[model samples]
Target: MHGGILGCASAAEAAGLWVMPFAGVHVWLTPTGHERAHDDCACVVHWSEALAFRRNRAVMTVPLALEQMAYCLGKEAFFVALESALHQHKISAEEISSLRALLPHGFDELFRLATVSAESGLESIMRYRLSLHGITVRGQISIPTVGRVDFVIDGWLIVEADGKGNHEGPEQRHRDHLRDAHAAALGYDTLRFDYALIMYDWPSVEAAILGRLRARAGRVVAG
Candidate 1:
């Protein structure tokens, strides 16, 4: 067996700091003769200098794990995990700054976009996607009688990205309806998207949001 530390998405997932779907294990072995003996199978191998700071013996340090994540998980998944780590206090802003030098060139902006306010991977993804369209989203906004919402767009639009686990059951459904009703009474438009809709049918979600924005824009102009 190869004596190596689990890195990248594998390490991130194990730390409970990653929620995105990934395939295969990623192991980081230093460039040593015994470490690089045979060709690998499904497990991804990274030949790099493993950092000394590690919480778990079997896994690499958070910074090193995140560096490997940037290389293997692409921008979106990496950003999601980074935010999750930040939210959980597993990683710090200083640690994230250290990673800027190690990541690919185009990924610098992702470090800037990373925020601890993102409650879940689904919220992180939705915010990132909307940012692509030049939409500025404010997250974790509190409103009287309705409590806190996920993302608020254009000051009047409440966009809730509900994950599979949190928003289930009849009681939760009833609460959600009451929140939406309260928001409506306060002249706010609520657009709620579930995991399936956000992940699979994004076009329809985008269309609905865009349509609402346009209508809101027209109302403002007319008044």
Candidate 2:
């Protein structure tokens, strides 16, 4: 019998084991549990019990399951679980569509998840799209002259996703302007888009980006 180190008090109680309240949950162990440790608090479970709990799918929360999978099976396995959750709930399509509207360059599903805010559920959608495109999109980047940009495309194009929080103060706006100037001086193209452009007028933003990419391609060819 194998058991994980962590289990809820209720679970331990149901198993007919003596449980000691620790934190918010019960910790279960052998009668001599107190004899082993000197200071640090840790839960001990029988190996058989741990294995049983691990095999019991109903015992784990989604986040817990994800963490377990990441620890045991690695990141690729975690991604599989992520995609399964998205599809199982029938949210993947909606998320992908939303991101497509915002980013025409195409993104992977992970981006959808990354950007889905808990309040609005957009972070997941953003994470998913970014995963699909394999864009390696990060939330923020700081360059010496550019200061910081919201996102970097291929380490060259600085993309700013201008939400209200980002543009609230005059100081922020001035700082952004300086960052853009610095990025330009460093031969990096900067693209800034407000929330409206990202959420409502994405086509225009896409076109601008596409045009710039095309121009850059032509320059490479000519040079």
Candidate 3:
């Protein structure tokens, strides 16, 4: 009995986190409910007589919340939330392993794509979307003097995924350009894309990345 209408709103609002709502609220139950839920509130009534799960906690348990997410939103989005949780230190590796074992439906594929450094859901989106095209991208890897970046593809291309909030300041912008220069000097090509560009203009984004990959391949062939 947590999350959804239970308690996530104030905290998510306070932390400036975005939560995607389904048709209804989510809850684990052992055959109990106090009042009638609202018309819009959809609930997941998992019948579990397990005393621990039925505890009157404030928010839903992290494992249960993550389980609800995986069940409702599909594995791709679940990994996004999972990785973001890991990055925020909200959950630990050992706990995640235990949780994964508890999750029904095989999760080898989902965990296979997980990483601890996806700073935002959008970064997870970037990496997962690219992966569907057989592109392998690693996140938050640091170079010698160019500092750390969001995603790197083919071990030679550096991609920086920018949400609207982070890249606004002139100083940050200047530092990004300097890092790009330094990465280029180290023989890596860099591409920076904003949240809107990646989310809204996905076809264009796909085209741009595929083109860059093809060009790199061509260069290698010529060499």
Candidate closest to the true structure, highest lDDT: 1
Error of 1 at 137 (Å): 0.6
RMSD of model 2, in Å? Answer: 16.1
- Candidate 1 has an lDDT of 0.80
Off by over 4 Å in 2: 1-139, 219-223
Q: Residue by residue across 62-158, what tens digits does model 2's lDDT show?
A: 3433333333333433443444444345235554454244332422433344332121112222333344444455555678866755666666777
Residue 6 in candidate 2, Cα distance off native in Å:
26
Please give the lDDT score at residue 179 for candidate 2: 77
- Over all chains combined, what TM-score does candidate 1 have? 0.86
Encode model 1's per-residue lDDT on 163-207: one tens digit a residue: 887889999999999999999999999999999998889888888
- Model 1 lowest lDDT segment of ten: 50-59
Ranking by TM-score: 1, 3, 2
Cα error, residue 104 of model 2, in Å, equals 24
TM-score result, candidate 3: 0.75
Q: Each model's C-alpha lDDT? A: 0.80, 0.47, 0.67
Q: Pick the candidate with the highest TM-score.
A: 1
